[model samples]
Target: MILWFTVVQVVVAVVAGVLGIVLGLAGRRPSDLSVGGLALLELLLIAQIVIAIIAPLAGNPPTGSLLEYWVYLVSAALIPPAAVVWALLERSRWSTVIMGVGALAVAVMVWRMQVIWTVQVA
Candidate 1:
């Protein structure tokens, strides 16, 4: 796992979360800016998925359970799209909050993935 890429992911997730909160508090629905941010996050997650797959083949497999790591990666990848769909259907300030929660969840999931990747198997 590339450390810098993980850092970038974390930053993006945090920014998305903050934007979501702001939008929600301001009583605004999902705007183009927020949607674009989520889209960027989705792209980053896809890139992470690709890197996670290739890194193992390149001789840098995770030290923890491979299944668990893949689960985290897949879940992280799915969050933004699901959130967008949910927000569209709900169409309210709560939708923004939902997106915020999803963004924060992605950040936590990414951190967990790093932990799983670096853990030493006894």
Candidate 2:
């Protein structure tokens, strides 16, 4: 729901997506750097989840509709493991596709968070 968090996710996702394409073009499988980047993105998502939970606990937080945030958070959480699994199962260009999928997941999560935070009406 945070503006800056959405920005971060978008920037990271775009960078990751570009990297995915580049890796694929290079004809290499998912490299250590790609996995490391995914891990970093996953950590950021994990922190965001904790922050989303704690901020409301510390003070008042948006609560009219929690499902949107939950869905995005869950989707973001699943992406890393799913990507790792998919990348291993499908190598070369397909592995890059899996990486791109993870990046897209981040973008989707960012968009969902933005909408959830910006909506005024219940």
Candidate 3:
């Protein structure tokens, strides 16, 4: 888990969570973003993916811990798309809950990634 990537993911998750809460409270879903949000997030995710790939190739500390890093990377990569689908399916107060779940998921995945990077494999 690169620090910058982690930070970006955390921030995005927070915003997504806040958006989810608002959507839930407002009784509506935000399938994707209004416009710019989705684009920016997509870009960020892409950057993160690139970095994730590089971390292993560049001989980052995560080298010995490929499994964990890969899993979390895949997890982090999935949240946004999942959020979009979930929000669309529940275009009501439940949308917020969807966002909340996705956002929190990102956070958890990030933590997992960090742990994987640091822990030695048996």
Top-TM-score candidate index: 1
What is the per-residue lDDT of model 2 for residues 1-122, given as tens digits with 9 covering 90 to 100? 57887788778877786787688777869877777677777887888888778877887476446776778788888887788678877767768767866887787776777677566445
Q: In lDDT terms, how accurate is model 3?
A: 0.66
Itemize residue pairs with steric clashes in candidate 3.
none
Q: What is the lDDT of every predicted structure here?
A: 0.89, 0.75, 0.66
Better of 2 and 3 by lDDT: 2
lDDT of 3 by residue, 23-89 (tens): 6677665645522343455567678778777766787757246765777677677776776666667
User: What would the TM-scores of all predictions be?
Assistant: 0.95, 0.85, 0.75
What is the per-residue lDDT of model 1 for residues 35-104, given as tens digits with 9 covering 90 to 100? Answer: 7788999999999989998999999888899898888899899999999999999889989988988998
Error of 3 at 43 (Å): 3.5
Q: Considering only N, C-alpha and C atoms within 3 Å, which residue pairs clash in candidate 1?
A: none
Ranking according to TM-score, highest score first: 1, 2, 3
Ranked candidates (lDDT, high to low)? 1, 2, 3
Alpha-carbon RMSD to native, per candidate: 1.1, 1.9, 2.8
lDDT of 2: 0.75
